[model samples]
Target: MQRFVHGFLLLPRCSLLALGGALDALDAANATLGHAQHSSLCLSLDGRPVRCSTGTKVQVDHGLADAPELQSLFILADLPLPDAARDGHARQLHPWLQERARYGMLLGGIGSGAAVLAQAGLLDGHRATLAWAQVPQLGDSHPAVLWSSRVYEIDRQRLSCGAGTASLDLLIAWLGRLHGERLAQALVGHFGLDRLRGADERQPSPVQARIGTGGAKLAEAVALMEANLGEPLPTEEIARLAGVSRRQLERLFKQHLDALPSRYYAELRLMRARRLLQQTGQSILQIGLACGFASGSHFSSAYRSRFGHTPREARSQRALAWRDEPDQPPSADSGRTESPP
Candidate 1:
């Protein structure tokens, strides 16, 4: 059997959780097979220590220019993506990544790394995903990449996922394609995973899940409300479309969400406005109108009532909260494992 090699390109403030999960999955697979069928190394833009999202420092085995023999390379990119063309570090990586892709090395991105790959023109015209709405700006033009909101995406040689634990699932799916289903099943059993998520599965939404569990009436009503948030439908019309009376719809919302139907609907719109405020560069009025509020004053009062802060304050605090989380220690492994650097 041929020994396969893999690599992870660690960017500054990369998610240690994503990296650790990917590494642990591979290590578990090797252990389950009772032999070392694969190996992995870490790479950085420079041959220096890189800081992970959790502030843990990792020592890479090599820099981009000195990559090792590898079957695949996975990138770990930051969200609110740093401008690759202008950022000095990203500029150093752009050409190096393009060179690797030209040779058909099965380039993949973990989480927002897909955005970084797109910036390098590596994922253009391909189905890729990042959990963010941010796109890389390339020479006043955006990449022609088909973005998906799925938990993971595997299009031919380009693999990507929302990362977190999803990276383990992506690896298993790719490995099953590479090796065999038998080994893949064994890996799953070794890890005791309840079920493997498919690549096409959409990322779960807490708001949607409120109605997604049970009760068809609640589901249809919430779905209609979500779809028509811009110009919200009347409670009566929503109830009629949901195959329930107005009173029945109100009761369902109360039972499931502990809020009246109108209150729940208003909260949903407000929550969406909150996300837009944090994620986009839109003006407060624009976001308010998009989420169905009629005027700036109305939106501000409702938002303050719900979140206890003004939209401007929320925008200023929009940096990713997980960036400051502490890195976790490596999981114990039966096979050879790399210690947290």
Candidate 2:
């Protein structure tokens, strides 16, 4: 079986792939392993040559719908996602992605492409990051998708990395997962990356971590929750961890996050559950427990309330659309499975 990496040019005749960053990383992967363990294909919206954000035109051999099974698919969209949205591509592509979870594949949004994923409904209930300037827009439009100011985030099967050199690290981190550090090093060496960093590496510039009093508290609480998702702490204990009394925690949430502590916590848990549902083939009971829900029924009820869809509905949506063929692993898998370092 031949494993592959796929790049989908989501922009019409406009934005180009971060040719140097993305291609260089992939080239390193090929050089380290001799020939290429991973093959790449460029699927354009219309199967035509499109210009890069820098005005370089590249030819794409197939349309997204006609592309073969890939281990990963990178949505390379320059500019704001609204540009893609205006072109009617967002509507067409959203349905395709909604089904990606079923096939056990992953989807990646590079640079402004995060907006495309958001527009497609893939980022809802997922912790996603985007270019800083677009963060407000994303937050305003998709209140359900948690907005992170980080350079990149991989919440389950969906990976969204910000623009520029960060993309190099994103792809390199992904390559490292499949071929091991040795191969990733060789690829980085081949590409002249003097400082080869791991996938979990952050950008050179620091992004603001604080949102508001509520946002800050929520963030701290989320960190605590993630660290203890396996063995959940009591609400009062979590309040203590956040340096507030239980009543204070509730008040802060109502003021900032617009929900009570337990309600917000349940939403966070359901968000995590959604990731597990789409990324792993874990059983529902197992996923519920892992995400800190008391039982499957509890998890399902909360998931349905927040997403307005059942956990099974969300899982089946992904399963039906992005399934792998006997010939190959689906492309989206590359962005989904790399463990955080």
Candidate 3:
């Protein structure tokens, strides 16, 4: 049986779900193959243990500088992309990563790990995908890279996914390429996965779940509203599209969501604005305009009413949170897991 070593470069605050899911898939593949066809090593920059976003501490086998040769290197980085960029962690690793790429080792990134590859200029002109929440941030930061909303993407030797169970899908597809479709199918069955999602499949919108059980008309109206966030449609137009009267649409929202149609729509737009505030570096005015607010004052007033804080305050709090968060261990009583270096 052929053997290969896969290196997982664990960044601080990486997503435990992404790391575990990918490793679990590989474990299943090894069992299905009836041999150790794939081996994985966890590594950090300085051979230190790293804490995941869920507070699980992952012990590393080696640091990048001390690691042996690798057939493939997958970066497990599922934290906020903006934090990764601001912390300069990827910049420190960029030179070594570029060297490894030159040596022909296949590179893959899970979640915001794609940001590191982009920082190293490896993803420039390459089509890649990342978590939808990070799209605006990373897309704005790396304009040269083609960012898609797909669950996963593979361009030549580069592989990337938006994290979560998507990591498993990417791994399963890679297993198929490495072994065969039969073995991949066996692993999928072993893992009890319903079916493998294709790499090009777009991530499901959260609004779908919100309006799914309301009614077809309500769901269609909500979808239309989501698609037109920048320029909100009139209630009458939305009702017309859903084949319902405006009064009926308002009744549906009140019945299903316990809110009026206008209120629900405003909440949706405000939620979007909040995401942009937390995730992207766009100006407050720009975000307000993008969310269909008529003016900055109007946006601030509505935002304060919904969230109990002005937009600037929200942004400031995020900045302070990011600044105050240290990569070091939390207190033992804090319930956050961390391992000593």
Candidate 4:
């Protein structure tokens, strides 16, 4: 008789979408493997309800302050967490993570949850993966932790994935370990996944796999642009980095992306600026400077043009969403069960 037991600690602003998706997959897996009896629970700080990134409410079953013993625990976090959320819940959950790691219990950090784990001193000297979008900040913040952009990775006891659907991959890998590949596959089938990702497999990033029309060079160029969102490059410089002439770069974007390189770059920069504006407490000027705008006026003009609203408007909406949303549940560690060809 084999049994699988796992628990997840939800952080403030955790991705409820991913959490719910993984939970749905887990339910299907349990049904397929006849393991509805599997042990699982969702925990939070003081066992309170949590709000997802998108303002959904989820009920949790326990609190780290209440439950101290679990075979495994996953941390679910979304980046740019309010200091209140991180310090209030995630920091409170840190001591428990340390205790679990010391005992060699499997620890999982989904998306930027790795940040919380790092704060706990659990991810020190361990290679980990985080949402690629947060890579820049994560690197600057957690210099002690080795970070990668892979879909999911497990270095010894620490496990993590980027964001979004890759969580399913993490859950699948956990099931595989507990019940063997047979049950893992059963779970994958239940979720309509065709295969499982190896530890080395990368979940596709938009910058890497150009869906509509770009080649490697263009993709690489896009990646560079994304990585340097806070400090955009000149069009000629981007062309140089991509090993294409300025004219050639313009032609490529026109032909494939259907947008000029300069316009696309500005859009990407503005998009990031908007995220910072909404997700962080940074001032509008700070956001503008960080996103490569020369001045607040420039950022405001570009933002209004592209989004049809001021940056302040977006921030206000996000704040409203955050304040109005309900609580959320926890997360689990499952890997991509389907192999990527």
Candidate 3 off by > 4 Å: 1-3, 81-90, 102-104, 119-121, 209-228, 233-252, 260-262, 316-341
**Please, what are the lDDT tens digits per residue for candidate 4 over residues 83-135?**
53424454445555676677788888886888778777888889888888776
TM-score of each: 0.69, 0.55, 0.77, 0.68
Give per-residue CA lDDT, model 1, range 99-193, as digits (tens).
76778878889877886787788887788876533321221133388777677889988998875777888888888787788877877887789
lDDT string, candidate 3, 166-278, tens digits: 89989999888888999888988888888888877876556556666448788788777866777889999999999999999999888777988778789888988998898
Q: Model 3: which ten-residue window has the lowest total lDDT?
A: 332-341
> Could you tell me how far off, in angstroms, the CA of residue 269 lies in candidate 2 after the best superposition?
31
Q: What is the lDDT of residue 287 in candidate 4?
A: 80
Each prediction's whole-model lDDT (CA) = 0.76, 0.66, 0.81, 0.75
lDDT of 2 by residue, 1-341 (tens): 46576665546433443545776777667766677766678776555677777777778877666666666777877553433323343444666666664576678888777777777777889877766555544564577998776767777788877777767777777767766877767766666778665434433322114343325665676566645655677889998998878898787667666777777666666666776676556787877887777877887887888899988888888877655523333233222221111
Considering TM-score, which of the candidate structures 1 and 4 is the better prediction for this target?
1
Give the candidates in order of lDDT, highest first: 3, 1, 4, 2
Best by lDDT: 3
